[model samples]
Target: MNLFNDAQSRSDSFTLDTAIISTRVYLVLLCISTGILISYTALTPHMSTIIIKNPPKKTYENLLKEYQSTLECPCSKIAILYGSFVSLSPVYHQVCSSPFISDEWIISSQGKSFTTKDSKAIQSFFIILKVYCSLTEKTVSDAWNIFSQSVLITSHTISNDELTIRTTDSLNQFESKTATEFKRISSLIQSYVATMFSILESNVQFAPYQSVNNNSSVNFKLMPTTQGNNCSCALNNECLQIITYPGVTIYDIGVIYTVPT
Candidate 1:
């Protein structure tokens, strides 16, 4: 009976050992599965962040290229920058400088009314003359002289609201004597505008001019033709007339220039 008891005890001990080994194996498998799940979760978001930040190189380059092209024209952008806030009258009419000045320089004028007529005319002429003279082969003084004489003509009128202005060469007369001068002037204007705006992306040499004595050449600020506005150009052909309303006029403003010796 003692021998039979000993064999039963050995069999029980063997079953207990087997259960402990099985429990250890299950614990090891659980640990491995948990580690893999944790690693996958951590890595996924990091990979997503990298993709979002870098994107495709080509996409970034194309966007930059588009942005630069939009600013290629300077005059148009400038016109918009200095826009007027006038409720423009249908009576607004003037010689279109678009053919000589690029379309980019043309902007919707603001604050259009009879009250601001003279200011508008002076502003318009200043803009056109500045751009035009910068591009011409002629010196600023000579160009201004030629422009006043050949292109712009202003006459006094009896009406307060109306002034007289006429262009020597109409839009259709590209071959006329005045039109030829306009064409030559335009070539320089385009070059200067492009250079000033860095469109050429190169160094530019500007045309030179001699200093004029105040006595020899008169400096003028354009004056708007309003009621009782006594401003007049002594020599009609030597000044520019800009339009404020359909028939209104003003001349290259006269000013006293103090020449440096």
Candidate 2:
């Protein structure tokens, strides 16, 4: 009687398990069927109440008009707006072309001569700029990365938002080496570029006229020339005195010079 009772209990447990499994299966099928019915109802166009939430036609038209007006607004004002929306306006022309407005400045051979005895810092910067101008836009970017690292060998200069040259970590020799090396390679690469572009068109520009004389003429000479005395009256010896460059490099002097026309 004990063995028979044990077997009967096992049979009851098995029956309960099977019932649970069947109920789960049935529930799953019911959900699937309900989803199918919903899908079918959704596709039926005549039963519009289910799918077409009747957004009022007038409201829709007004919204469409609003969108059209937004698109029609001047692209100049809306596009590329990070404090220079009007700078690139097609209606007006730029003082200098877009290519000339790069972070780098192109100092030509003629312009460079003006700073022959100039600061090493300014001269080095111009060398980098001249290098940039020689290459394609893509190439210029590649060169800038390299030159940026090297320019800091002297010291990183900060002229506000205008320019800020940086070097890698000074604490680690590895970083310093990398920064210096990057600049050296970048300079070599861009030197070829600057030379190539020099043959095409002279994009280099001199510094703005530092001295305008009484007659409205610019004086580019470091010293007062005999020519200025006879020409329209402008500038004196004070404006053309010998500038002192002590701790500064050759390039810094040049940066401060007025480019000759």
Candidate 3:
């Protein structure tokens, strides 16, 4: 009887020991798994944070690239809708109330009402007036360009007096007897003397901010030029060209230095 009792106690103790060993092994495995999970979580790359390492913006060429890139519309993007609205809508307020300033800087103007007495004269007048607006815009653009080169030395802030002087100088040069000078100055400047005032109207201000200035000249090798970028020499049109990066393509715009009527 004693021997049987002792055997029973020994069997019970052995079972308990086995369970304890099994539990210890399971606990060790669990600890190792938890450590691995923690290490992996700490080491894994955080995709949410990103850094774009572009060079500093310190030069005119770099600033020009950034400015052109940011210009969502040189004039306004609403022109397409405005034109469609003008064509389709019976609502004059919805349509013609806001006129389109073309990408080419041509504005739909409200000219004098046509007179029945002079149909051909009226038609010619309309054409002339349209041409005048374009010439006016080009004049402003030229002043901006001239002033931009000047701004490289002077303040980015353009003064009214400075604009006036530039305009006078431009106009005087235009009146000069040299045909090439006149043509060049005219191509370089605007038509309405007032555009000299207006293009400088509340625009043309830029200062280098460490926040957004990327001073690297556009890698023309990486992003090569197309025939369209040479539109300034070709014809007076807005040239939009594509620039390809790794995964995406971007567009940069070009302008014709002159507007021919």
In lDDT terms, which candidate is top?
2
lDDT of 2 by residue, 114-225 (tens): 3434433344434544444443343434534443443222222122222221222322443355456666766676555445433332233344456567757765533322
Question: What are the TM-scores, per candidate, against the unseen true structure?
Answer: 0.17, 0.17, 0.19
Top-TM-score structure, candidate number: 3
- Go through the candidates in order and give each one's C-alpha lDDT: 0.38, 0.41, 0.39
lDDT of 1 by residue, 118-219 (tens): 443433444555454454423333434433343222331111122121222321242254446767666666455434323221122233344469567644
For model 2, where is the 10-residue window of minimal lDDT?
A: 81-90
How far is 241's C-alpha from truth in model 1 (Å)?
58
- Point out where model 1 deviates above 4 Å: 1-11, 46-261
> Which prediction has more favorable TM-score, 1 or 3?
3
lDDT of 3 by residue, 1-261 (tens): 122334455679775566667767878898999999999999996755323334233443344455544322122131222122212111222212222223232222223232332222333333444554565455555544443343212323223466457556744553343345446655554333223322322112233334423655332222212235454312322233222222222343232121221
Ranking by lDDT: 2, 3, 1
- lDDT preference between candidates 1 and 2, better one: 2
